[model samples]
Target: MLIETLKNRLVLACLILIGLYAVVSIGGTLFFQYEPNSQDLLQANTGPGAVHWLGTDYLGRDLLARIVYGIRISLTIAFFATLINITVGFLVGSVSGLLGGLADRLLIGMVDIFWCIPPFLIVVMLTVVLEPGIKNIFIALGLVLWIPTARMIRGEVRVIRNSPFIKFARLNGAGSFQIMARHILPNCIPVLLTTAAFSIPDAIMAEAFLSIVGLGVQAPNASLGVLISDGLQSFRVYPWQWFFPVLTLTMLVLCFNILGDALHEAYSSKAKGLLEHD
Candidate 1:
């Protein structure tokens, strides 16, 4: 079944990478327990050797330790923000699609209005207004990211509502909530899940960009973005400072993208099968 494939390959890979990140994040607290911001200029700029696996930065903090913690924080932000995006998107889309007329028109128009605004600009402006921290980053990213997701879900919902299944559900005297929950929403799950996978990397990169601009995760809290920002200042002298964080971030993003693509294909195939069955 499609579920088996998702588990065997795409979902499994994502889970494994997520698990590795968790281990690095949680294990560090028990072992190194190195304060990510505690500076030790004496041990600064050391390359990977017997002691440090990824080496120390200009501040002499363990790069590996900081990155581990940073990944934890970065992933946390992405996961939660994306969750909020999907929730809002799904709700708005479902309502717009299931309830046609002026309400649907107004909702769809609002989503389009949101889509017209540049997401990055909105995030930057919000970051400027809000106090900097992990939570603020989450809010900024979620607020902007939901627009695209809502658009996609709305499109999908519009298509599904016209299908025979929806008509059948309505003919059975099903309530709006019952029809959506029992028929429309279940059909939309694969699309929603795939879209969610794609959103994670976007959220991650957005967080990094926000941090680089000095509005994201504040000092003392480790984030891949903040780490890269710090690394850039000394990039010429300590190329390793930039190299490792960038490499790790690249791999994480790449993995998520690949997983998203794979899920999308699989979902499309499943969607096709469901149609055939109907």
Candidate 2:
């Protein structure tokens, strides 16, 4: 009943839209060649028209094509970064939470140290040291983003570790690893799942920030961030340059956040019901 109540139709619709956008972006890149960087002096800066729907860029590059390609790269980076964050966070969090004393203290201290360092500042520092590119952006963001997730997971782990089921498993001669894998880990699902769902938008937004700072998604790549940054130079005369890319980014982020929140509420409600039953 709680799950049913939390099943938001609006969120479901947004998730479907996000999925569809991903398919179009990926499929278009694999099958077509619209030339994201090919310039045409004759067609430069033309407003929305039949030949050029979204219009051409400052260099007369196809806006639609660039937007499509940009979406693919942005989404890919976000997905991979989120994956790394989840894997590292879950492992670190679970281990720390399941084991108290020295191990927990060390992990907690590390997390606190990382928390003191701002993520954007870390990314900027890394960009200065490391070569700025798509891959580097992912590595930098993943390294910093995992800290928060690890903390969240660790907190969840502490709660789950004390649950009755985990206690029973431990009493039945289950080893620490076995208790974590079979009992504690299973209960930690709600936290892990929600953390992952929330991380997607954060990853996407982070990528945009990194790109805007001139340290990510290099020239001719056409990430929405790159597009917006380039367009901002001519915001007064050619507004479309900044308008469409920002619009696309806004929609994408909004959809992901809505869906993530919906999933979070659903799982939280489910967890609450389970606790009540106990």
Candidate 3:
């Protein structure tokens, strides 16, 4: 399965792009001379050249540096937010599914309530209510973005909980925790990976939207959305400011989406094959 997934050209290409972005975002400081926040008034609004590869923003800050750093910030936030999202969703869903009865009903009911509300609206409200910063953004995203994951996980766990292997494990004296840890979770890996892949881009876009509206990652610290917002002022005159950031953001999101689709396809095919064999 792993070999076949790697053989997929679209999946391979998206992986490479995502890897390049991750590498640049993580180790960019080593390669770039300019700091994202560094300013040079004289060089402000300059076009792409030897000194500034991508160009300069209105404040004469290096656009390339800012974009790389922005990518880093966005990825970092998304990574952590997704971690929180997965952890919370896993706990809620697994518990609800395993316990069943009233607990399942209550938990699913709560999740359904959240599911009905738009995630973006929930995130926006949370960000507005809480302080505006990376931590708050993480919290807001973590809290709102787990609904789908929870619902999916709940269904998956419910099905798995009744499987022959699970019944065997229970007969062998395996506790709920042991069964969940050793058996159930391993079975759910495909779902978790696919959900996580999709969730990351959702988080990235959400953060960008929040930043665009001046509710996320304040000035001096550049996020793609922050750069785009600033660039809109000079968009007519110097388009590079927004163009590069927008392009990078688009590619980043696209790569994740494609990767998610690839993973879903791979897993679905594998499942179908197993079912046919059975």
TM accuracy, model 2: 0.91
The pairs that clash in candidate 1 are none
What is the model-wide C-alpha lDDT for candidate 3? 0.89
Segments of candidate 3 deviating more than 4 angstroms:
none
| TM-score per candidate | 0.90, 0.91, 0.97
Candidate 1 lDDT over 1-278, as tens digits, reads 34655666656786688678777776766767566666779889998877777889988988988898899899989988898888888888888877889989999899989788999998888888887889888888888888877777777888878878778877889888898788877877877777778889999999999889888998789899999999999999888889999998998888788778877878778778988997
Model 2: per-residue Cα lDDT over 166-272, one tens digit each? 88878889988787778766776766666766777787788888788788888767677888888889878888888998999898989888867776777778878
Instruction: List the lowest-lDDT window of 10 residues for candidate 2.
Output: 1-10
lDDT: worst 10-residue window of model 1? 1-10
**1-278 per-residue lDDT for model 3 (tens digits):** 55778898888999999999999999987989999889899999999999999999888999999999999989988999999988888888888898799999999999999998998889989999997888899899999878888888898898779989989999999998898789878888888888889999999999999998889888677778788888888899999988999999999999999888888889889989988998
Highest lDDT: give the candidate number: 3
For model 3, name the residue pairs that clash: none
lDDT-sorted candidate list, best first: 3, 1, 2
Model 2's number of clashes is 0
Which residue segments of model 2 deviate by more than 4 Å?
A: 1-6, 29-33, 171-174
Residue 170 alpha-carbon offset, candidate 1, angstroms = 4.0
Cα-based lDDT for every prediction: 0.84, 0.81, 0.89
